[model samples]
Target: MQDEPILKVVNLKKQYGPGCQWCSNGHESIFEKNRCLRCGTVYACNDLSFELYPGEILGVVGESGSGKSTMMKCLYFDEEVTSGAAYIGTYDDGETNVFQQSSQQKRHIRNTILGMVYQNPVLGLKMDFSSIGNIAEKMIAAGDRHVERMENRSKELLTHVHIPLARIKDEPKKFSGGMQQRVQIAKALSNQPPILLLDEVTTGLDLSVQASVLDLIKTIQQKFGISMIVVSHDLAVIRMLADRTIVMLDGKIIEQGLTDQILENPQHAYTQQLVYSLI
Candidate 1:
């Protein structure tokens, strides 16, 4: 791992609804889990902060409504953050807070510097577009105008993700869940981004298919040396992929460390429950 982080996030916060004085004044007493009982405001992500190192897979494990997915959405610009700062080592010398960038700048960053694969393939791929077309679309967004180059790159990525060349021209809508997810993975990698955000990418797949996708992800990371943040509720997934793990609960990171360390010696009660459940 590199000494400096490839991506750094500081005090990232995302919430829904306006906060009441009780919740806004740093009083946890007025909140129920991550929601403010008094004002009905939901703190979907509360002061999340983490770093992603080059060539490392960082696992974020949390149950439903725990804000892990919300955090990914905020990082990928799918949802606006209420407040926080993020710096990318390759963007502007890692000095600018990406959240404060203009929409155009953010779009540029999304298209070129970062890639995201949504848990639902529909959210990531244009289902009706040919699988290759979906990949070309992302390349085009990044200002690649050479049609031949796009096609070649798309084919290369698709093949790398284990999408059969014979089916490259087919629309994702006609694919099985596993195939669609593989196409989504190919599309996300079309830009050759330094950072990849995978939000529960294998959630609904069968066990065998999920294993295939996981192995593909590991292979991609090793081959491309891409830094990735993989969010999943499954500890088994985390163990298989992440070099480091961050355990989240109720919108906060309750524990984090080397994946093996966290698994073997879970300090938090919630993390212990998660670890023991894998037994």
Candidate 2:
């Protein structure tokens, strides 16, 4: 049996405030440090733990401000886990403690070993560059790569994500939301990473489009044998896609079981409340 998890997170935490340059609201001062979410103050993700096995589609569901996105970022090496440990052991001849890497080292590992699908499609693609060019830039950034290799790989990944071969030339704004999401998926797959972090991939889409995208994700998961972590707020989404489910609340896991087990017989009051509301 496999001993190590394809992805493992333990006691992770993250806090944000105005000083983040990359965040949409650049934290120029103490007052503007974090994004203007409800409280307009710094937000933190406290202790959380979970695991994803190869070819597994694991769903994480919770209320707003539940740290789902932050945890996803920790897994993807974007917002580094401020405390605790994240163990990512890849079967493709790789093993690393994600929290231990420096920012530069983590950046190098991102596209090659960890491909992330963000909640906001805009976050995954570059704005000024052409869609294809943006992808090539990511490939180059993955390992200081050559342009040609990045281009060819970009085309291949676009094809894999079911993007029209020709659409690669257009800028991202020209595409529909669902279509732009496809481009984001293509970009995430560009480096052939073994693990994929999907943060609310279906948010804001109509149910029909949401189903299609989820189907595509399921198909790719089967084809590539990649382990995936899907974070979402909808119970139905979790019910439909997850092999196993971890119900989280207040920054800690409350219950975990086969998807059916939790849905049919929830052990925790918080899990029951969510399940009841769904029914």
Candidate 3:
């Protein structure tokens, strides 16, 4: 069925500070309340679980410090998970938890199964590298050796992301913020990974630039049928890209459903506030 999940996560949590009796005994939402009054531990992310279906865009919406980005970090393996399991359907028949894999296996998963675009171009792209070289770098990490093939693929991806072929030789630092983000997108997709992780890709761009990048993302998803988990504080971005949406508060998912449903009829109080604030 088209609805089958391609990626699954369960009971994911990430915490800062050592666990103490107070941290364990507290009942308040860490995100809403800021910190555990007794233990001083902060829950950057807590008890996150979700499924991303094949060819579907899943949006995660929350305020800053709500652990949305931390969740993405966990999924991308950029940050260590405190405790949880994530499975990619294509990996070992979905039997192995990605968090439990060795560093080498994690690298393979990052290169071959998952692609991520960070909110900051500096975080995702090598600003000093030419656009073509940036994409080629990813290809090289994925075991690509044919220089000509990598170049061709880079050109095609650049065109897809609406960066001109003429600009392919330019370093990202020479481009506009939007253009730099586009280069990042092209680089992420260079290996044709099955799943993509986009973290606030439009955060710092002008409104028009943001729209264009969002459009490019939609087009790419349609063209490649890739599953994606898009993280952002902007409801507009989520509306434009996600079929299903999850509302996270403090480090936990409070509500989730179809994008229209979450926007139109949010059930959780936090979600209602988030939805209404956009009006």
**Deviation from native of the Cα of residue 243 in model 3, angstroms:** 0.4
Candidate with best TM-score: 1
Candidate 2 lDDT over residue span 53-97, tens digit each: 877889998887677787787777667566787766752344566
What lDDT score belongs to each candidate, Candidate 1 first? 0.94, 0.77, 0.90
What is the TM-score of candidate 2? 0.84
Q: Choose 2 or 3, whichever is better by lDDT.
A: 3
Native-to-model Cα distance after best TM-score fit, residue 186 in candidate 3, in Å: 0.3
Sort the predicted structures by lDDT, highest score first: 1, 3, 2
lDDT, model 1: 0.94
Residue 200 Cα positional deviation in candidate 1, in Å, after optimal superposition? 0.4
The per-residue C-alpha lDDT of model 3 at residue 184 equals 92
List pairs with backbone clashes in candidate 1: none
Candidate structures ordered by TM-score, highest first = 1, 3, 2
Residues 177-236 of candidate 1: C-alpha lDDT, one tens digit per residue: 999999998988888899999999999899999999999999999999999999999999
